[model samples]
Target: MVCRVSGILLAVASAAAVGGCGGEGGPTSPPPPGPPPPPPGPTIGASLNLRPGEVHVLSERDAIRAFEIQGAAEGREYQVIVMSASLSEGRTTPLRVRARADDVSPNVVPNARTNRSGRDAAIPPARGLAGELRPDRDWHLRQMIETERELRRLRARPAEGIGRASRGLAAAVSDVPRVGDTLTVRSAIVPGGGVQCTANTPIKSTVRTVGEHFIIVEDDRLAGRFTEEDYADLDRELDEFIAPVSHEYFGEPDDLDGNQRVIAFFTGEVNRLSEPESGSVVIGFHWIGNLFERENCPASNEAEIVWLIGPDPDAEFGIEIGVDFVKRVARSLVAHEYQHLLNASQRLGGQRGQDTWGNADLWINEGLSHVAEEVTGFYRQGLRVRGNYGYTELIAGDPDLVAFRDFFEGNLENAREYLSATTEFNPLALNNNTLDFATRGWGYVFVRWFGDRYGPAGPGGIVAGSGEAALYRELAVGGPGYLFGYENFLRAAEVVAGETTTWGDVLAEHFAASAADDAHEALPDGAQFSTWNWPRLWEELRTAGVRGLTGGDPLRRRIIQMGAGVSSTDEFDLGSSTARYYHLRAAGGHPSMIVETTIASGGNVPNSAEARIIVVRTR
Candidate 1:
């Protein structure tokens, strides 16, 4: 049954569940055969619809110190305590959350009673909403809560090795078809792909060939999109362009002989086939489920490489350019995915395994992949560096004057909107879309910097090991007994730079003073030095003693503390009709990069008329 609340149908979990939200009185209806998917869930907190720089603050008297939301079925709603209160006002920054497709009723399936068993039975107790029950609440609620708790707890724990996210992933591999054979399987990463589907009801697929180095499979529908020539061209391109790049950086293919080849799967309408935001055109993932015990995934073989393909020039994915753009995107996708395949290859002992999945910060993994794109040099033949490099640099570097004209002339909302727009354009979030490029653009810059300064493995040597261990190993800590862990990259930079100076000192000398800064610059040309038009920002950077440096920096060069020399928090204000961006390194007990935007004199700002603050942590 569906309880209508606020004109929206609400499907409650189980009656025994606690903390569930209740509907104001409404009518009930039967659940439909298949429900429309839910919007993406909140990341690390409740759905506050907060802007990037906005913060959610709670007073000290609140009971829940921390809580996480576990989004389950489309219709079912589970009650979860998002966060607890602290004595001091707690600040929470905005985070983007990805919708999950693995939220079906967990216990109903065979051996699905626990995460290892394909069920999430070990999570803390959660309550069901007070509304009509679409599906039995207990199983779905249990699955959702347990899965979330497990994932979160896993994130909190140290990184082990890359592995499957659940026992179900083992099934994903077992469902694989041998070369020259046809088989059907459920779509896990794709949209409209049922979560609870079995062999009887699966996406039709076939493995046409298992070459010495690659196994090719195609969705029945996707195969129809390409002609024989198209398939041949695609195969040749992968063999010639993509595989070679992967081998060069990540070491040789696991097996050069035909005995064990990587498995590549292609699908059509990839954007529509799965939750739109979560599904990309090309994907290569190693199942690392934190909730369940380690299980063998790519079941047919532990080393099998899984590839999910997307459209050739898919407009839905913002690729509205042209065939050249599409082909360029496709090549990058192949290279990026193949690198992931290599990163997770156990045969190479490349620091990938079940535990390493999601554990390696995006900066490291995506940065390396971006480096892979440039293995042949950005401008050289066979490499389409212009698109990736140019766009990302434009976004990373100085803000475009045209884009901010309205905001500069208008009010605070306009400024926020403009800033948000720029952030969305760049991914690796570290540098606008740097976070989105999945850590591609600026990340590539970091890898390049580290490699040039340190050596081949350079920092990669640490990344090739466990995540937490690697981080602490390089970061210095002031302790009498500690042998490992530097306080930060600063101390480590001293060793790498062979000097007493900090990374900040070196960056200023290289970027602002030298000509090479043009080629090695991570931000725009004018953003550094005195060229930046925003006087307030320039002053803040100089006063903060952080000039030209931005979050995109691997060392997090600029530090902004309240009473530190960098101007008071009050200076963050730039009067009404003003927009300013400041990058300050996290200091003292707080180890995070703080990005604060000031809106002193604008009527458009929804928050306090005085100013607003949002802190970005450099993980």
Candidate 2:
């Protein structure tokens, strides 16, 4: 009986299933058909003006994309990403946009319809669904969108809109790295009042307050190393050197604290404080590491000057390193380092606090520092001006014969030495020993020559021009056509000459002349060379007719164009045997030549001496 009932129930269930297929009473009748195909995908009758909306979404296909659909208006940039998309098959949503995201830019097409005639409509708006959304990495897309929108709002004039947008973005993202930041290293001592690091390595230390602008952390055990009077005098000398002198040259105050204080660490390990292989007895050195940038370190604007004392054999006894000698050396070191600080801090190519030694030829920076020693009178202290073995003293003797002869010879020798170095470094390149022979020796001579030949307004014009009164304007960049090279210096020389002149021509002419030439002879059957001191040679050149002397042939009038590459000759009668002046201008951009008559006859007679004037281009 149970088996018969089971068969009947099965038959009845199969019949009901068949009826349900054709009946409206079925439990799963097709989902009440989702609201009429979303009104034929809402016609894009007007321009698809999108406006700002709360909901944003990011969808990536080929490239990342971010946008908002609701209320998206024309000419308005949107930052929000799209959260949902209501796209349809056989129908296209007109995505009119000039969009850029990462490396992808898609062009917008106008009048693109969601469907063709008689084709299926777009998916319903209510059917919009969310897909992968990445708002974090969408800034690039937003930036492009903003940039484009701003451009469009300005009537597609990209010059104004795009430029401003780009600058804004750059400014927002750019940051000054801490690559050369400096901290105030106040005087400190470790626990147990241990020794401070100095030339005297193991001496107990006491951080002594050495007044404003400096602190002397001295070795307590070597209290007698330097006297209180010595410190005071040294301090006074330093102040004098920096104020109204070094400060005037750089056109800025010393790079010091508001109180003008600096720290001085006197130690026994002279070699430890100085550069490697810098000899065993180092007088002093400035820490260049504090000026240059390190891999992950910031540099300091001011350099801490270190002095090696009582350790160097020469510095210990009052022999070659007498008290006066020590004082002079210390002051000179201060001046040298201060100039370096100026170079590193002064503006170069629109950049400030840059390493000038790295940017400019090392010879220039080092030469400038060496020149600073004389210009600031650090080398003159404790001795007569002429007694010091400085640039000024080196220029002693007649300005015409001895001084200029010495100058040229020095320049040639130093140049040859530098070029012949086995290291194969360019003469203009900077290095550890750059200042030793060439820079400090010949380089200083050139600097002095520039200053003396041009007066305060000439090539050495840098001295007066680069003063605090001038606001320390960068003469090298904006003030004039000055560059950091010998060629540029020649340009300044011409400017000082008040006519088109080239130093190259002058130098070449000198090189061709015999050492014993009568033209440059001071006395003994020669013209009166300028009576001015050698330090004032530029002033004399400014006033004199001829800039240089050539061959001893006194009869042949040699017209030397310091910066020319051609040659010519002319003959004229000396209407009077007495001196007659003539200004000769020639081709090849040669300077306006100033010629004074040289006659074989001594009397004032219009003699047909057939005076011949030869013009030569030196360079």
TM-score of 1: 0.40
TM-score of 2: 0.39
RMSD of every candidate to native, in Å, equals 24.1, 36.4
Q: The CA-based lDDT of model 2 is what?
A: 0.30
lDDT of 1 by residue, 1-619 (tens): 1111122345755433233434765444544446554643211222222222222221111111111122222221111101111111112222111111223221122221111111112221111111110111122112223333444454332222223333222234443335547655444332343121111234577776545456666777655454555556556656665565456445544431123456566655333333344322222232212112223211222234454544444454332222332223444445555654554342223233233333223444544554554442221232222122222222233354221111111111111222322212222123221223212333444444444333222223212311122222232121122222112334544544444654323332222211112222243331122111222332333344321222121211122332122222222212211112223322232211111121222112223222222122111
- What are the per-residue Cα lDDT tens digits for candidate 2 across 1-619? 0001011111222223222354665555443423332221111111112221211111222111112111211222222111111111111111111111212212211222121111112211110001111111111112223332332333221111112222211122222212122223312112322112111123334544354445454544335556777777766765655434555554343232222344454544332322233222244444433322211112222223333343333533221223443444565556655665555434322232232223343445545555566555422232222121323333444344332221232232233233222122233433333234434433444343344333233222323322122222232221343355555455555544443554333322221121112222222211111111331332233344222211111111222221222222222222111111111222333221111121222121111321222111111
Candidate 2 stretches with Cα past 4 Å from truth are 1-223, 253-265, 269-280, 292-295, 298-325, 348-350, 353-359, 378-426, 429-435, 457-483, 487-619
TM-score of each: 0.40, 0.39
Best by TM-score: 1
| Predicted model with the maximum lDDT | 1
- Give one clash count per candidate, in the order shown: 56, 32
